[model samples]
Target: MGKVVVVGDRYTVSLFKLIGTEGLVLDDPLNLETTLIKLKKREDIDLILVANDLYNPVKEKVESLVIEQKKPLVTVIPTPFSQGQPLDVKGLILRALGFG
Candidate 1:
């Protein structure tokens, strides 16, 4: 199976690394597009979980790229600051399935 990767801030990378997922520390929003493009080119990577902070700024670009391809699914994960609110699991699922 392919691997999962997390691209976010140091803390986000560290958190996922502990669970055996590979991660890259990306603290600059300006570099986010380039970073994601590089990751998408890797055959070994199957999914990318990006912290909400970093993902929010490039949401449109990221979504377009993901929807145009079949692999290396990119998803946004809530950061600590956004974790207090309840997640809309159903909406997420629907979107993931392209039913929303």
Candidate 2:
């Protein structure tokens, strides 16, 4: 079985850590490409949950890799505890349970 990895800010990484998921805190945008490349080489990582804030900066490159390689599926996720449009917890649960 493969693992799920989170690449984002300290807060984003920390949250995943609580659930025992491995993550990387990437503070510099300039190093984003390098970080992605390194993660791509890791065979144990099957899914990458990239924080939306960081993903937005390198959207093109990330999208291309996801579309072309199709390994280690990449997804953009909202920052945990971020202030924005409120999340629909109930709806999310329903969807997860295949009820929505």
Leading candidate by TM-score: 1
Which ranges of candidate 1 are over 4 A from the true structure? Answer: 83-100
Q: Which pairs in model 2 have colliding backbones?
A: none
Query: Candidate 1 at residue 2, lDDT?
Result: 75
lDDT of 2: 0.72
Q: Residue by residue across 1-100, what tens digits does model 2's lDDT show?
A: 6777888899878877776668899887557777777888989877777777887787776677656655676666778556577655345334533469
lDDT tens digits, residue span 1-100, model 1:
6777888888868867776789898877667788888988999977777788887787776767656656778887776556567655446534654569
Residues forming the 10-long window of minimal summed lDDT in candidate 1: 88-97
Who wins the lDDT comparison?
1
